[model samples]
Target: MKPLNLAQFHLLIIAILLPVFSMARPGLAQIPKEASQIIDDVVVTAEKRKQMLKEVPVSITVIDDLEIQDRNVRDVKDIFNLVPNLSVSSQNQNVTYVGCRGVSPSMINRRNPFVMYVDGVPFSKISGYSADFTNVESVELLRGPQGTLYGKNAMGGVMNITTKAPSNDLEGRVSLDISEYETYLFNANVSGPIKKNTLFFGLWASEYQTRGYMENDHPDQDYYDDRNILNVRGRLRWVPSEQLEINLLSGKEIRQGGDGPMIGDSQIRFHEYKNPDDYVDADSFDNALHARFHAKKFDIVSTTTYRNATEDYDVDYSYGSSSVSHGILDYENTTFSHELRLQSPDDRDGIAWIAGGYFEYDQDKDNEMSMQYLPTAMMNFNRKTDWPCTTTGKTAAVFAQTSIPFFNAFKFTIGARYEIVNKEMNYHRTTTNLDTNTVVSSAAYTIEDDWDSFTPKASLDYRISDNIMTYVSVSQGYLAGGFNNTIDDPDATTYDPQTSTSYEWGAKTSWLNNRLSCNLSIFYMDIKDMQVTEYPSAYVMVASNAGKAHSYGGELEVKFRPVTGLILSTGLGLVQGEYDEYMGYGGEAYAGNKLKNTPEYSINAAIQYRHPSGIYTGLDVQGYGKTYFNESNQDNSVRDPYAVVNLKLGLELSHWDFYVYAKNLFDEEYYTSIFTSSIRNSYMVGSPRTIGANIVFRF
Candidate 1:
């Protein structure tokens, strides 16, 4: 592999500041020849508590620090192939859309089905998702319902992320990457002690900028949707005694405006328009305090968090027609949450238990939205519309779970959560013809409602043998109810919460003296009052309860270390789901239609090798089966099955690592995002073949 050019080095100085990226040297002395072909142990916090991977009864996909760096996963979207029965993709620079299992968040509703938590604090509002990962210790994906512990919006699953804590010993890493589309990244992280074991501090910074890949109509503007992102975080840790540990963390991310939401009339990704200069800018800030106290009888954990996020957008909505229309949207959210939990002493031989209480307040919406049109040659009149609204939610829940060992080989676990939620919204809308100086339409209303939910979970674990463990579990989960912001009638203002009941059976095993590992899981789910979207008016959508639906699926993950320096892994997923009864968009009877954006199958495989000469090479393949983007299951809008491969080769040396890689090696063309609505279908083109190089320095 060739070294990065001098220009590439200069570009790296422009972006990123980070935590981890330690890979590339495994083929030389990387393993020290003492690894003995034994696979590494994986530990996860799946149950709101830490446990060995094999002992956890849930189907989980854990990405540790090594894999994060090795796989070049800067953020969650890069792990789409690492998890089964999941669709992970990015929206602009701030939003990451994850469709877990068979359930997905509706395009109209702002709430995501799956919930994400960072260092014990949940993002009460999805808008504040951290777009980059810095100094992360691990990321866990728990598939299926988890309401008993996660409370609301976990009807689908959960993402538990842990960031590395400050350490007494000084440690640091800096890396640079240059790729196609004028993409450049710079990441750095440092941690040390201020007073030996008593106090420590850490800081991380990263900047990412991309000129984009999609073509634009303008000759000079090569590609649309350019992006610039900056993230920085700091941590302070206090270890006063053996009984207590506390950490305070604060972070901020800024997304500079590059362009607005891309939408096209057809599935083609190319954008053709008059003014492509407008864009959207977004910012997010977060602060969290986490404390862990070791008591004589139990452990107490407390977390307090506050976050503020804002976004602004200005775009031209002229659908390639002669007329011109423009829209401006400003949005903001403020969230505060506190959680306190007590856990039985870990490493105890007896029963294990956890009980906790949580409270969160979310200001989901906080500004007025407007749409305007200018008088053009083809149109004679000028018009404008404005809607102002404030939406907020308050949620409180108490949860508890216990695991009891019995018969020397069997264990049973049960948990439940009782939650009360309330949402309030006050909105007003007005439309006027500017030239005529007259009001054409106006509406206003205020709505407030409360909901109560009781979710329970139970599971049985059996140790068939020292190498194999099996489990069966049943759980219930639900999403909170809320009102629509851009609605014309108050009668269509609110939508009920959707619920799911899931049953699952799974097995985890190791063979060949820990050289090979395999895990399997099968699940069935019944959904009631499924939330579906309606698009009667352009840019105005509503959420309502559809009738029912059911889904069944299976997943398998395997890893084999056949020889000392070679590793092979594969993941497969199968799913079949359909709406049992429902009225879809436009009040159409769409019962028995397949769920949108869900595929029939998914597959991912990888192979890696390390040579004793400090050389490494790897390849990965990932693909998804047939997928439809609309409720009608139309063939024209289907996402045909496609697969892409990536290759990487690098050399590792003391204090430095060099690597070259190519994504979409064959230059495959695919869609990264697909959205279908009454107005038009918008698509974001996936990355094509791009070659890049990464260089790392550690101290």
Candidate 2:
């Protein structure tokens, strides 16, 4: 595929917008009434309650149902391009790493700096973070420290998703999608009222399949294949009186597929494993139940969830020869969680306040097995090994936030949260040495820890006018402590949580009769007790707390509708993150080194036009500056800067819609993620250009 030049890109954008501009007069009936209504009705979950997006003082991005349907985003990862200061990388089918504001975990076992929530329920377990989002209604991203309201594991930020609920009106939709790359997707949803005011029901399901992108070139000719995923959800809402309302929801997801393939080998020209069939087979299922009650003065919510995930992977020992095999390894895990929260009502007087108490419990069980592929006699040692472990944790917190109107134009907000966390772990390992041909058994050991954390936040907002506001805030946040199950050393119990104090100032303004809006913010964070990982052996990695670090960044976002049928959005972010103290090879000074997997600068912009004659077109561009792969700041191996552009052209009639999209239109070569190790290093390559079209009919 040929890359598009800068001039060619601009021409394409002009072609998309010219027709729409010619059809509709400038500044006349351009904005759709429905779209304006949706913007006015935008509600957010960032404040731990429902509030309008324009009213909240925090930084938040919302992708509503219209955006979700128009963008054709398949998964949660696909939404990263639409948000600022957020990024995602997929390691495998069920494993993904996400970061916000340069705050992400070193690996899988550590506590996640960013917390994910479904509806009002917190999804805390490691396995539940990557749950499918087939039936989602909206996704909200809250930036900056959030510990005062959300508690532990929200040190970086939060991602909250709300699923579709049952409706009083009878309506349903079904969709089937097919692509040239042998990808298939099917989705169906139905909802209606069972009774006038007492009952309602909703159900949704989705299935997807795709062929592996890599070629094995081996005899098996087996491709890395993935199977269908099934999901179903139901909702019930009852209003017995004018001031009382009860809602209940239940959902489940079942998935089976091949683990994502490794894009590159440490040593090229050694075709050790070229076939996707040699990849791992992974599967997972998640089920959840939630209930909430809304009253005049108080609200209570409860959630119960269970998850099971399993993976079976094949490892080849040699670089070139397919004959060598380390056999197959399997990992299985199960988790159960429950949470309850009680929230006070919003105040209407001079002091507006909200107070809440929260409690959460989580339990996880994990098992791993090593199996031999060859015969027992040829193995010469025990062919199977078993490692089983269990972890239990509990958290209790009390939080409160109050806003005082000191003057007509100025308001002060104060918030605080106190949290207590307790964790316990039990593990046992049994293995056989291949050389000695003898069994090695290890007894189970137990570890326990308790911690108390306090977080506080203060902010002041001044309303210059009805359409403009300026605010400044200072907040402290903390992540929870957890056990390192991947570590082989018995002494590697738990690492302390990371803490940060962030200071931010920002302004939001609207002009030109609400057709243009802009927001800008500058922030600095001082992070202490950073958690870092060290690899002593080929497969053994240990987690520990490191010295302090610092990050400073700025973000600018603008949305403008210059004329009728024309919309433009642009965002720019510049970040400089570094570690104050870090130990590297030969004990070199690494104080000024850049943080891993973070770019110093990024830019995103998009333009869309819709004509009165049922034509719609858009163009999007995103760029990422140079970044280092490791905290040691190695110059020899670094990911170069890159830019990607996407194009969309569509036409809509009364009941018909058609569109074509070209993603990564330039076909640029880049790395989505990079991991380095002394024994074996790897880098995951980004996807190439894809051009496809879709047609939809509404009845």
Candidate 3:
């Protein structure tokens, strides 16, 4: 498939949204009104309380169900392109790098700066963050440091997702998607009151399978990266009284797929894996109990959550004309968390305040994080080492925030969180000569560490009329220090603590009776002891501190409805960062290199038109600016800016919805990741163009 040029891309977008305006079918007489004439108001719980999006003094984007449906947002990964400044680099179906602003974790580090919360259950672990968007109500993205309220590892941002609740009316829907590459998806959901207004139940389930994109030429004809997954989510709600409600939520995901990432050379190549153990199997389970009691003046909310995730990976580790393909790297993660909070009523007249306490514990049952397939800074060839380890951690925190109204239209807010963390690890390692059946070295040991931090935030906002608002804020971000996945360094020096202070100013405005809206924000942050990867020797790689560093950026989002049936939307995010002072492993100074895995800019633009005859058409473009895969800023580590286009056409009726989409319409050539390791470079190719159709029936 040939890719479209820059000029054709723009013209295609124009054609998709404009052609429908010339038609006025006879069925127009039955159409009530143009749905796009008025923009809908959004409500969000960004600060742990119900509030209007325009009233919150934070930089946030809320993806409502309408937008999600129109954009074909199948899973969490699809959201990265809808929000400005949010980016993701996927090495495969299981390994992905996610970040926001300019703060991201080292490529090899297990700790992350971004965190996600689903129905009060937190998923902060890098390997435990995959889920399908089933029965979802909304997705809220907080763009900057959220350490003050989100508890842990939210230095960069937070993704707070809420699922739809059961209603009194019996309702259900079923959908099936058929696409290229022999892909098939089946989804179904049902929800209704089990007993009038006292009890309700909701359940959603989906199964997906596909013959992956990577070409395989092995005699076995087994393709690489093929995927098969099943996901099921259920919820039960009980309302004992007008003031008391409780909900129980549970979800499970099971996946059996081909080997991990498709590792290719500087150019593309057909893969041939003869290893018998080359496959990936994974499963995740989540359970949570949430309760709320509302009084005349205050509300009490409590949530208890438990999760278990496990994965077994065995891949043919072949890259750049070499192969070391055998054995297994498996891991299991178990977590438990509890949160209790008290907040003022949403309609209370006095000052609003909230206070909460959170506690969590996690355990890594078994795995080999230290002995991986990475071509470290010191080797032209890869070596096989065996290091299996178990790690355990605990975190406790108390937080409070208040909103005080003054001067008629001005509001002042202040919030803070104090947190304590402790962790321990035990591991055993054995290094053997590749050509000999002899063990060159062996060791065993146990290590423990602890750290504490305080993050605070302050902001003031003023309503400059009924439809316009402006605000200024200052906040701090913190990430507790941890240990490296290496036996060489077992102390706190291996994982330095990171902290940052940021300042921001922003405005939100709506004009012409909601026909147009614009939001903008500018921010600058200063960071200390940034955690990054360091190659100490050609044979050893570990995590270390990169001294003083800073970043500044701006964002703009706009929406306009020129005609009653047409809408146009676009957003842009610009971010830049450089190290102020840093010394590499061998005394090589890296004082001005860009941050790894952080894009310079991100953009999302879309246009949509719905005719009176039930015809719906949409065109969207998602793009990212030049990005570096590593901190070196070398030629082999960077990729130029590129954009991908998607098209959607659908029909809507009282009980049916139908659509066909072409994703990556031009079959654009792009790689999700490009890194220079050892003597050559390896690439993780992105998805190719896909053409598919969906059918839905609602009752």
Candidate 4:
């Protein structure tokens, strides 16, 4: 399918929104006079408490259900541009790299600098980060270190997701969407109360299939990147009394798609690979139990969760060439985690506090085998490796905060948390090589390691006025050390833990009778013993400690409601990141290079309008500056700047919603990742233009 002209698409959106403005004006007149002048408040839980976003001292971005639908944010990758200083790189379904404010982790088994939580349970495994977002209520992106409320793996930031719960009224919705390239989707959800205010249940399911835009010129048959996904979730809530509540949640996600990236260095618009066995299959399932008890002055909460996941894929290692090299990789993981917390009353006037304890156990098994079919010699070269690892960890922390009202107009706040984590891992691996079904070499090894660390955080916040607030904070973050998967050398089996100290100041203000809001923040980070993954040979990759580094950046977010039905929002970020001192292969120095996958600057802008007649339209544009994909910072490793535009339109009747959306309207050719390994370059490109419409029915 060919893409439409960019100019025409923009005109179409503007025409639809502007031409009917006069006709919609009468419907707008029916709105209550006071409602048109009132701007709704946005509530967030970044600080572990429900508060107005403008009152929170930390830097946070909230995406509500409306924004999620208008922007077509299907996954985490889709929302990166919506938040300042956020970026992600995905080479395939098996591996994804995420970063916030230039603080990214090495591509290995080490813990990620950022963490994600779904419905109050931590989703720490990278393999399960791509879970379905079918019934999410809201997403909160907390910037900077979050060690106080959360423990390890939050050095860069945290992403917390809340899913919708059952309501008293019987509600259900079904949706259908169709787009170009034989893409289709079906989604349905139902929720109702089983016994008025005593018990409730909710169920949701969705399926999506698409024939992606990758053509194979070699064979007359289709070589497109075919993808299929299925997701289902169920929830049960019981509130027997006003003081006690219990919840049970379960969900699963299944994703299957083609093997390797569809594009390389050549922008020829077609993927040409001779190998036919190229595919990836991944899935995950999770179950969680939560209970809460409200006391006279305090509350007690507990959560227990179990998760299982698997990722298996086969790819052409030759990059569509005739080298006859291919690879098969597989992983299976299971995890069990539990947490308990106590929280003070929310309406307390003087001081409030919270304390929590957490524990988790994980088991994983991985397998990889590669082969080269040498047609010239009628021979086969093969290598196989299998790994089985287990990890156990326990974390204990106590946090407290107090607010003092001074002169009735100003308030001072101070918060701190002391956390200690103990973790152990056992790694065992075996590798074998065979030539023409005869074993040429074999090796087996086993290793075990234990690590412990203490992290503390403190912050001070002050309010200047009822509509203005500012604060400064200093926080410490840590990532646990672990053994590397590239177990070629006995001595290079384990890497040290990574730590960081961050200093930040921010302000949130509302002006023009709360119709306009602005938030700004600047931060600096000092990092030590950063984990780095390096390729020492054509087939050998190892993890090591890179000495030290520093980074500084700033962000600005603004939202304004010009008129009753028009809203405008935008975010801008600037970052400067470089290694303070570092040494690489052959004793080479790389002390002055930029950080990998960190963009210099980025911007996201959007305008949305809604009328009383249920007509709504929005336009969003996002742009990113140049970024380096490798530590070397060579010119060949840079990805140039690019921008994408999207348009959405919908009509909301009493019981039905009809929507049309266009993503990547200009068909921008952008690369999500580019890296040079073993004198070979690989590139992963972004998706092309997609135009689709969906109709939803609710009752």
Best-performing candidate as measured by TM-score: 1
| Tens digits of lDDT, candidate 2, 1-699 | 111123333335434644454344233222121233011336776776666565567777787765665666777666766777766665555556666677777763534677787765565433435544556778988888999988888877888988877656554544555554455555656566788666777776666666645444455544443344556666666666655555666656655555444544533221224433445555655556666676676766666666566666664433333433344555665555665666655433465666777677666655554433233455554343455677788888888898787779888989999999898888666666655656765556788899889999999988898778889999998977777765456676578888899999888777777788887888999988777766655444566666788888978888788777777888787778888876653465668778776777778888877787878888888777777766776653467778788888888765446788887899876766666654445656665677776654332
lDDT of 1 by residue, 551-667 (tens): 899899998998887888899989888989997657788788888767788888988887767687889988888877777886655777888999999887655678899989998
Residue pairs in clash, model 4? none
lDDT of 3 at 208: 76
Clashing pairs in 1: 16-206, 16-207, 17-188, 17-205, 17-206, 17-207, 18-188, 27-611, 28-614
Mind giving the per-residue lDDT tens digits that candidate 4 earns over 1-699? Answer: 122223334335434543354344333211121115345678887867677787777889898766776777777887777999988877666466788887887866535577888887676555657655667788999988887677778888998888888867666656677777767776767787999999999999877777666665445336546677789999999999999999999988898877535554635354655345577888889888989898999888888988888888776656554654555667777777887888876656656677777776766666443433333443444555444445555555565555555665555565566655555555555555545455554455565666655666655667778788888878887777777765656577778888889899999888999888899999998988877878877555677777898889999999888788788899998888888877885476778888888999889999988888889888999988999987888777798999999988988775557899888889998877775675466777677888998776555
Number of backbone clashes in candidate 2: 2
TM-score of each: 0.93, 0.86, 0.91, 0.90
- Find the 10 residues in a row with the least total lDDT in model 3: 24-33
Writing each residue's lDDT as its tens digit, candidate 3 over 1-699 gives 111123333334334532342242222212132476877678999988889899998899888766877898877779888888887766546655677888887754565687889998888776757767757889999988888889658888888899888978666666677788767677767788899999999999987777676656554555666788789999999999999999999999997877544665645443544343357778999999999999988999999999999988776555323443344668899999999999998878659999999999988766664343444334543456777877789999999999999988999999999999998878677776554546767777788888888999999999999899999999999887776655444543347679998899999999999999899999998999998876665335567888988999988999899888899999999999888988886787889998877789999999999888889899999999999877778887787788999999999875567899999999887766775544345677767889999876555
Query: For each candidate, C-alpha RMSD in Å?
Result: 4.1, 7.5, 6.9, 6.0
Which structure is stronger by lDDT: 3 or 4?
3
Candidate 3's displacement at residue 227, Å, is 1.0
What lDDT score belongs to each candidate, Candidate 1 first? 0.79, 0.66, 0.79, 0.74
Candidates ranked, most accurate by TM-score first: 1, 3, 4, 2
